[model samples]
Target: TDLAAWAHQDVPFDRLVEALNPERSASRHPLFQVMLTVGQSLGSGPELGHLTTEFVVPELRIAKFDLTFGFEEHRTEDGGAAGFDICVEYATDLYDA
Candidate 1:
């Protein structure tokens, strides 16, 4: 029921944050300090009607949150499970190696 409720409600994240009005901080996210995302990887570029497309990963070092974990599943040629690519993004100022 919670998932259905969430699906019916289309609220922007910033608007939700503003409505909630969690404690503001210059060093962390307003509502959450960490986040996680899991999805399938984009293996190849898609073809448009008459244009070519590609997926380009930008070289970004900025962290919007204190920590974020991303998991992407890659498939093989025959649609078999190839492997998983895991990445952890953290704020350098908040964490040290």
Candidate 2:
């Protein structure tokens, strides 16, 4: 997975956050700041509805989330923007005991 590879290959976390914006959203959350300083979301999404904005991986766990840009699975007639759906999904060795 790209994310795993990035960690293995030493890609900066900041770049990862920059590329982590939502594919389809009315507005974007300030995710880059959160993921950098703290490793989780503060859940400051709009007051009305929940937003699926951040992706979290703990420091002890390594993840390879198969996400890519420019691979939109659908398009709207109104010319709104969307992005890659995970052709492959996230995988980690951790399991519930």
How close to the true structure is residue 27 of candidate 2, measured as C-alpha lDDT? Answer: 31
Error of 1 at 39 (Å): 1.5
Task: Report the alpha-carbon TM-score of model 2 versus the true structure.
Answer: 0.18
lDDT by residue (14-46, candidate 2, tens digit) is 675567654544232344211211122232344
* 10 residues in a row with least lDDT, candidate 1: 5-14
What 10-residue stretch in candidate 2 is worst by lDDT?
A: 32-41
The alpha-carbon deviation from the true structure for residue 91 of candidate 1, after best TM-score superposition, in angstroms, is 0.8
Q: Cα miss at 80, model 1 (Å)?
A: 1.6
Clashing pairs in 1: none
RMSD of 2: 19.6
Which residue runs does candidate 2 get wrong by more than 4 Å?
A: 2-8, 22-97
TM-scores for every predicted model: 0.82, 0.18
State the lDDT at 89 in candidate 1.
93
